[model samples]
Target: MSLCFFDYGYSLLLRHTTEEAIATCIEAIEPARAALTSQLRNTVINDLIEGLTKHDWFTELDIADEPPPVRFSLREWINQAKEVQATVFIAEKQEALVKESWEVLKQNIPENSLRFFTLVLEIAPAVKNMFSFLKDSDEIPQNNPKLKAHAVKVFKMTCESAIQLRQKGEVVVSDTTLKYLGSVHVEKGVIDPHFQVVKEALMRTVKEAVGDQKWSDEMGSAWGEAYDQLAAAIKTEMKQQLEAAPKSSSD
Candidate 1:
């Protein structure tokens, strides 16, 4: 049988074995499960069962004859479910923050892009050399369509990463994507340190767009953590690429 079907059957069995107490446990988890896909929902349910089994809570149940191999104690199971419920609650909050923040962000993409590029230049003048396409442009970086497009893409990716991170089971950005991004940067002569500058510029743009009233500490921390994770993944890939590359003859 599919794990989904098994999960449902297990829950029903729990209701019979533990009575109304199981209802309270399910109640605590229903909100979290409501937004998840069936696959992820089943994963969480299975994880909860695994956790209970690891704690040997199932052995404590006094079912007549043999306990159906997956028994659970009401008190212990509820406690374990509460822990998973807390994670789901936090992910929901983070997802809300990302969505609301992006709404504020998309309102003025061009302006924010300008701010990001300007900050990037200010913090790391050397980065200007990397953007050879803008070398001869007399127009300001913010007004440049190419620069604006690049900024928008970066912000969009960041928003997507945050959303993925908030999803059940931490399904954030994929390793393949991160590796490709890192490889592209490596070809562009971009190093791991450059990501810090980019992150700072991006955060500054977000703050400017959202303003202090809407940009709470939680939002800042969430974005900060998300960026850090992306940067780390990219840097890891970059490091691997460098290590695998052929050494120079001079070396």
Candidate 2:
């Protein structure tokens, strides 16, 4: 969490600072050297950067500052800020879209989970067999209690992971969860093809839940991309299990 804040600190510093602060900073210490620690300067200079930043260094402006290069360079800073703003803009929008859709799903877990699995089977009927717990006797997920339980768990995991992608920027799967998922996937013969089927079904289910009013290309893309990261994590663990298992040799 602190690390995320640390990263954002750099972006905020560049995106928010004014040309005045830039000029002041350059005039005080050549970007490469600090007045307080420079060998050429035996005496300490004013901490204008700190004071200006805390007081009014970043008094939100409609137009960005275009600072002329002094002894220091502004090219890199300007370029980096532009890149950071573009990336951050996408991440922030995704987080909002994910949270907005997730709220609806959270409100009615059984209904949404049922809808999700129904889409899965509709997309690929054979995919239903992958769920050993569902059994051949179960016609569809609507009447199956296990389907709802499993669906809720999986759907919740997906949304939570998607929601936190920008907040934490990485998946933090536990050892136990990894082992459990790998074992189940191995038993079900789950592979990339099956994963793709489920991913599509999920995207469809989320779109249906959110409705056309809130749904958009960007929202779908956000969920799809986040799920891709999560599916990668699961696949990595499953690959390890497959490699570690003993194989039968030609006799």
Candidate 3:
């Protein structure tokens, strides 16, 4: 059987009580499997039979000219179902943490963004040259209209990227935006080293905004993973675009 079938069967088992009901649902969904062939159907049936046996959901009955007896173990099925439930419960808890922390962070986008840029510049002063608006300023100026606008835009983009990463399994989040951003940054001479600086700056900003009492290690990990994915996508596209561009006369 295909991994898809196993996944579907596992999902059904997670929702239903009886193995028979699960089997019925699986068979019922056969019509929706697109171009399913007889051989594939048989394979799926065989896989189900094997899975049921492995999970101790089978029984044998003595009869003439009939299929063998198959006993279903309710206790075993319930145990397996609980495992799936536990996984889902943990995922939901993590998602809730991210959302809750994000709500607090969004309340002060401008402040957090300022903190982010300030931290970045403090860690890597040379990066300041990349920002034209801050060229004449030695420090991240507070309440500068241009700085505030830039910060707000960056914060919003960060939030959007995180949300897309969080829901990636359920929905398709195109990397086109990130790719374009990467290309633009590359044109401005931004390189890979800047990514780590941005990540550190953003993490510090988030921690300061949300407070240590509310932020957990899991939340930090989730945010890190999300940013890493976004950064990687951007860097990859940037490299691809740079490679495709014609070499300058200097090169």
Query: Whole-model Cα lDDT per candidate?
Result: 0.72, 0.71, 0.70
Regarding lDDT, does 1 or 2 come out ahead? 1
Task: Using TM-score, give the best candidate's number.
Answer: 2
> By lDDT, highest first, what's the ranking?
1, 2, 3
Candidate 1 accuracy as TM-score: 0.63
- Cα lDDT tens digits, model 3, 24-96, are 7766764455334334645555565456557642544334555665443655554555565565556555556
Give the better candidate number (1 or 2) by TM-score: 2
Q: Order the numbered candidates by TM-score, best leading.
A: 2, 3, 1
Candidate 2 accuracy as TM-score: 0.67
With a 3 Å backbone cut-off (N, CA, C), the pairs that clash in candidate 3 are: 58-71, 59-69, 59-70, 59-71, 60-69, 61-69
Q: Is candidate 1 or candidate 3 better by lDDT?
A: 1
Could you give candidate 1's per-residue lDDT for residues 1-251 as a string of tens digits? 45465469557868576757777766666544554454475577678766765774355665567656655566667677777777666666666786688788778776766677788888887777777667775545556778778767766776677656765434366778877787888899887678889888878887888888898877877777778877777777888998999998883
What are the models' TM-scores? 0.63, 0.67, 0.63
- Report the error of model 3 at residue 45, Å: 18
In model 2, where is the ten-residue run with the lowest total lDDT? Answer: 36-45
